[model samples]
Target: MKKVIGWSLGIYLVFGLFIAWYLFLGANTDIPAQLKGSPADPQTFMNERELLLSEEYSKIKNLLFFLSVPFEWLIYTLVLVIGISAKFRDWSKVSAKFSILQTAIYLFWLSLLVEVLSFPLSWISYNVSKTYNITVQSTQSWMKDLLIDFWVNYALMILIVGVLFWLIRRNEKRWWFHAWLLSIPFSMFLMFVQPVIIDPLYNDFFPLTNKELETKILEMADRADIPADHVFEVNMSEKTNSLNAYVTGIGSNSRIVLWDTTLQRLNENEILFIMAHEMGHYVMKHIYIGIAGYLVLTLVGLFIISKFMSFMIRKWGHIFKISSVKDIAVLPVFLLLISVLSFVSDPVSNAVSRHQEKSADLYALEMTDDNKAAVSSFQELSKAGLSQVNPPFLVKIFRYGHPTMLERITYTNEFEKSEE
Candidate 1:
């Protein structure tokens, strides 16, 4: 017990110190004198006040972002070390007549505890966004969304937990393989239903209201062979000032969703470039590829998790107050391992995503043949989102899924110059 506690404290210190070092001292923020005058210049993308606000806002956000992963691990480690999970496991015995219900009860309490413990960070994040005028959502709306998210996440996780324990009981050695097999279709089903079903719970979505703009987008979709029958737009300006567009779902239910904020903030040409970028994802089959990659990662992750979890339980089950692989109390250990693995693998995932996004950017350029619009659109996105055009290397590796704003703009500008 002393050893476990010491190890947990050691990890927390190392993670916290590393995040502090990279965040404060790793990257220079200076903009080159020549680049200072350009719209894509991170330092000059906004007015004086906006620039100041963006700098302060990005700093707070970066601190929160870097801390979030290890913070979760900390929570799980604390929960495990304190025997709270064992309490949850024993408390759920009242529902043991129904094993499924017992499993659900244990998971619900465990997840709820995590959320309650983590709410302060969520509140800090919300207040920061609100202070910077990034989000316009009120306290009531934000809390409502929080509840919705909790329930949605709980619903999915309960299903996963039930399958996991059932597999362990049936065949402890093969559970990981069987669980991985089950996750593939389960993942696909969620993707298929997300845009059509899950998304509407949070925001309204309908065919784009500006008929003329919608027509142009639909035509672009046709040219790209995306088979998108309608362009969808969500009422996002009510909650956020961020400009965005995205591709969501798959097959017949697939959608090209634009934030109404995007339409309000950008010109038709810029909107076309944004929409074309989304269409590029569809044309390139990035969605299918992403799904395949997720499955492969899960397969490997589950295998490793299963082995490590069993070993931890076998070696320290007494210390953990966990009796067996089938004990629900072992979950925190499982979660801790998963979190660490994800943090380690995050850079590789980000690199792959950046490559995909870069490809989508070039595809949009080819489809639109408008370098000016492409470059300007990325600049506008950075300005509106108050994003650092070139964040620190570690920050970019962990948090950014797309190329840096400067990288995208430079690539687009270079493409134009090459053509000329």
Candidate 2:
């Protein structure tokens, strides 16, 4: 009993570190050209460097992400199988082989369960979109797109599981070592292919044609002493009414994208604030900080994964469709560990984001004098976007990128008070 617990704990810690090491440390970490600037905006330059570095790192992380899906199914199944089996017999006496068999069954069953769960939701989402007049495509086209999405995802799942399980069965002794090494190149391939390949399948994106809006935006960028790049508007309104704006790409392709909804709804003041917030993410280097933090966490996690994976294999390795501790199937455990880590680290992520948002709000306040209009912008967001005034704490923690409507209103009012 003591041995089992020790083994599980040990496996969790070491495997976690092993996973982290490759994701956070082994990936490329280069600086992007856009992020490079003079001393005036050192933050932008630093962020660019981190973003470029992450291009290499992201490849690793994406591969690890794909690798982890089956692993999690394995973990989920193993826990259920082992927990159920332990109810009937002395856990210490159960053969590793028998435990592995039960886990395989568990994995297959869970996959079926997931397919069932996903199908209904997917159908409902499409139906809802049509009801809202958000989708113009016919039902046949939607179904075809859904089918394509499913097959793409299903293929990836099969590949990850097949490779991970095969490796684990082949090398029960040194799986983590090989898995980490292999992930580096697999990650690179994914990065090279993703933007050009994967994303285009789902949505239409084209260059922006609004010359006046583009000119105004560029003028603002110049006034702020920030780089002026191309601006693009995505045909996002074709599918959904939700509003979003982002600054994407790195070198020559670096551009800003505003959703059609955003362009249609916002006045000049509101647009300026939205721009400031997006620019804040760039100027303050949030993306770089986020990537760096991810890399650091991954390195630490991989180190832990390497140290403790064997114990996990001995106990429930069968659940993951692998018999050896060295197998990459244990990547799921690393994910669970990171999820736990993220829960613990939520406050930190939120704090940094909130501070950046506040700074951007300040920037917006300085740029515009229409305080009531600024406050009204948020009110318009709530009303049009159907955002809640106040959300539950748990929901806020999990979902919100910005403060709640109530919080924003309070902040805006306070800012106005301070001005008077």
Candidate 3:
């Protein structure tokens, strides 16, 4: 346990230093010069100040993403190594006669510990966004949201852990498969209610008050064969300066939500194009595809984890203070495996998302028949968010779910040429 903890902490110390250098000393690094065609090219869409800010801003956010994954994994591993999970396991049984009650008790401490340990990264991310004027959410409100996030996820953890342990105890050998099958409905239920039930907890949503804009969006919806009668606008400007619109939910719960910031910042045509782009997802059934893909990945991931959990328990179970995969103490090991494997699978998932986003972009251009709006809306998006037009390879692979601004703009340019 000491050796494992020592090696893990040692690895992070070295990695943390490199991330520090990359952010501070290497802020001057022209990492995107290759993609941009030249360093600080004056001919770019953004002015000099915006370009410079985007470079630094994008780098910090992207680097933090890379840094946090392993940090989270380490925290999970440390808990198991130091017997925190074991301690919790014992504590959970002290008063709880029922296994479900014990599971909830153990999970509350485990979830709280994980959240507290991982919070510095969360704070650092918030601070960076706050410093850059990206977020307008007050520190008080931010903390409120954090607390809400904690409880919400805690409740979810209780449900998930309860189901998992029940399966493990009842069907030890095929528990992962059974759990994965159960998750299909559970996951879909979450998606279905997310827009109506989950999302409203964080922000207020209302029908687009701009009747003119609402009419335009509704008309576009009609043209696209989308059943949305109302376009919802959420008051996100209170929290962030960024602009966005997205399609969420399924069936009657389906919504194309516009951030109030998007309405405040972008013009009607840009908003229409953005709406059309979002509508493309519904028309193309991307949401269903995404959900299906998630289930498929879960099926595969859980299978691998089951195999790994069996092998790891046999070899290092004693070190982790757990005798078997069914042991409640093995929860941290389960989460750590998930974190590590999910990190490894990120590029593949992100690549698929990017492809779907590009398809939507093409659909928008065709629907709107306005390459100029498509291009300028992307430019406005990049400007408002201080987004990097061309990101580095690592960021592209791991962080980007949509095409970079440069790639998006290039597509419109190609469309314009074809029309000519």
Candidate 4:
């Protein structure tokens, strides 16, 4: 018990120090003179209305941001308690005599319970987005999506739990390492199929209808040495008013995707810049980099879970009604550990994403040699998405996957200045 507690504390401290050091002393890009402004004052770059809207949006989002972590932890803990207190293990035994099937059944029920408990939070989020005029989806559509998500999640939980327990049963001593090995190919397989299979299940995707713009985007792709073939457009406006574009898949499946909202809201030059930015992600191999990072993190996370899971089960097994680490009822406890690790390590992951995004921004500027277009595109994006120009430091550290609007705009300004 003491050893487990000590290791837990050590992990927390190490991650905490890493986050602090990275945020405070890491190699951050400099904010250019032209883009610097007090948060209290409206910048000349954005109109007064736009600035006011951005501030209001920032306040709402920041509140949600701060509330989400604790709220999620609380909900997860509650579910764990409820599942254990309810003697889900007994129910699982009655439902299925086979251990693997019992585990799967228990996992599915627990997952469904979590989803039901968490639905209120999801509903609130949607309501808030609607209040801010960000979301365009109707209640019926939203509910439909939620239903789809629940079933999909339930199916996935069963499969994952079944495989995980199988691995544990197969290799009691080295299950974590084996699970990590299995995850590599599984992750790759998901990436390969996601664009072609999973994505289409959620939203409608079509080839870009604008022949002229498609030609222009392909030309830009050609210039970046990315394969020129097709650009896909997703009907995101059906759900949200926000603008977005991305590069997804790998090898033969690789493609550029744009939101229909982005096409409608941004000009030709701005869209070009956005496409260029996504192209940067492809050309820089950020996808592979991200996959490599996930592989390492997964290995470490699984190892940590293995180290302390036995101790945790021994200490609380009677109280929680869980017999052992391999019990179906222990799934929630396993999920709890992984979730805690993920929450603590979020800043590191976000920092890596921000770094990639910054690199992509720079690549876009160089590829197009159009600083004004890049800056304007970012401005439009920030406005459309209601993004904070300069968010609080903690928010930036914890939540931001890309640099704030202020940072990107300033970076472009500096790029232009350096050219001069």
Q: Per-candidate RMSD vs. true structure?
A: 1.9, 14.7, 2.5, 5.6
Candidate 2 segments exceeding 4 Å error: 1-75, 78-116, 121-197, 304-309, 318-321, 327-351, 416-420
Clashing pairs in 3: none
Give the winner by TM-score.
1
Show how many residue pairs clash in every candidate, following the order shown: 0, 40, 0, 0
TM-score of 1: 0.96
lDDT of 3 by residue, 1-420 (tens): 789999999999898788767655654434345546432232456788887787778778977887898899888888878888899999999969999899999999998888888899999999999998898899999999999999999899999988998898888789999999999989888989999899999999999999999998899889988887899999998899999999888878899999999999888899998998998999999999998889999999999988988898899888777898888989887888888888889899999999999989888888888887887788888888988765766668778899877778877756742364
Superior by lDDT: candidate 1 or candidate 3: 1
lDDT of 4 by residue, 231-305 (tens): 999999889999999888877888789999999988898899899899999989999999999999999999999
Candidate 4: segments with Cα more than 4 A from true spot: 1-42, 45-49, 82-86, 417-420
Candidate 1 overall lDDT versus native: 0.86
lDDT string for model 1 (39-128, tens) is 568655567787777667777799897777777988898788788899998889875778888888998999899999899999999999
Per-prediction TM-score: 0.96, 0.61, 0.94, 0.88
Error of 1 at 398 (Å): 0.7
Q: Candidate 2, residues 1-420: lDDT per residue as tens digits?
A: 345546665765666566566545654333234323322122322354443432333333333443343344435444434443232223322433453443444334444444564465456555644554445567777777776776676556555555655666777556555655665566555545654566668766666677777787777777777786666677766666666787665434455678777888888668766776666666766655655565555555555665665666666655544454443334445445555556555666676666667766666666554566667677666544444454444435544557765566556745743354
In candidate 4, the residue pairs with backbone N, CA or C atoms under 3 Å apart (3 or more residues apart, or in different chains) clash, namely: none
User: All models: lDDT?
Assistant: 0.86, 0.56, 0.86, 0.78
